[model samples]
Target: MKLGIVITHTDPETVFNTLRLALYSLRQGDSIRIFLSGKGVDIDKIEDPQFDVKGQAQEVLDAGGEFLACGTCLQLRKSGGSQICPISTLKDHYEVVRDSDKLITV
Candidate 1:
């Protein structure tokens, strides 16, 4: 299964859980694409000692999960994006949603 995850929030716990799910899906032999929009592009900055979002995200990436970040959103926040949040466009977002077997928005 190809899973698409569209994230528009910056809440640490939420983002952490989202990444956890992505990792799990990847382990299940599913492909995952995570699109970060709005404040979600700030995922690299989320620092929660308990959640370990960055760690989980890295695990997901290592497990073959992909990530995309809204270019406009990054520009609005003055960010050049990060390893886990590469700059992307609406077309990429649309493709993820269009191609995935399932889509989850958070």
Candidate 2:
């Protein structure tokens, strides 16, 4: 199944867990796509307490998971504009939501 997970939080721990689940799903032979919205687009700029958030996100990418950061959200960030994850709009997100077999928000 194709699972789409939308991440809307800026918390490192929370983002860590969300990516963890994405990795797990990939390992289980499922396709996963994670979208960053709101403050969640700041993952590459913040410092986590214990986890390497960006590294974890890279791991997710390395493990064959896809990532999308909201275009408008990226533009709003003070440390904005990253070439790491591709930028997409809410229209793209809605199409993913419509096509996904399962949907989750974190």
Candidate 3:
């Protein structure tokens, strides 16, 4: 199944839990995609003095789950640098949502 998980919350724990669940789905052989928006874009930024949540996000990426940060959200957050994850337009997210067999939001 194709699963798309959209996370808009800024809390680290919420993002972590969302990715953990997505990771579980990926490990089970499901195609998974993660869309991080709003303050959730912070979850994609990688820098020194990193937290466990950042590490978890990296693990999700390393495990081959599709990770996309909303483009407009990134712009609003002014997080336009190498620190953030790949920026995805709202159009892209809409397509993912449309194609997904299951859609989840956090």
- Best candidate, lDDT: 1
Candidate rank order under lDDT? 1, 2, 3
Candidate 1 local lDDT, 1-106, one digit each (tens): 9999999998999999999889989999999999999999998888988899888889988889999999999999998888999999999999999999999999
RMSD of each: 0.6, 1.6, 2.8
TM-score of each: 0.98, 0.89, 0.85
Q: Between 2 and 3, whose lDDT is larger?
A: 2
Which residue pairs in candidate 1 collide?
A: none
What does candidate 3 score on TM?
0.85
Residue-level lDDT of model 3, residues 1-106, one tens digit each, is 9999888776766777787888888889898888877767777553434346777776777778887888888888787723336888888788889999999999
Clash pairs of candidate 2? none
Error of 1 at 54 (Å): 0.8
Among these predictions, the greatest TM-score belongs to 1
Q: Which residue runs of candidate 3 sit more than 4 Å off their true CA positions?
A: 45-51, 81-84
Q: In model 3, state the lDDT of residue 76.
A: 85
The reply for model 1, stretches above 4 Å from the true place, is: none
- Model 1 root mean square deviation, Cα atoms: 0.6
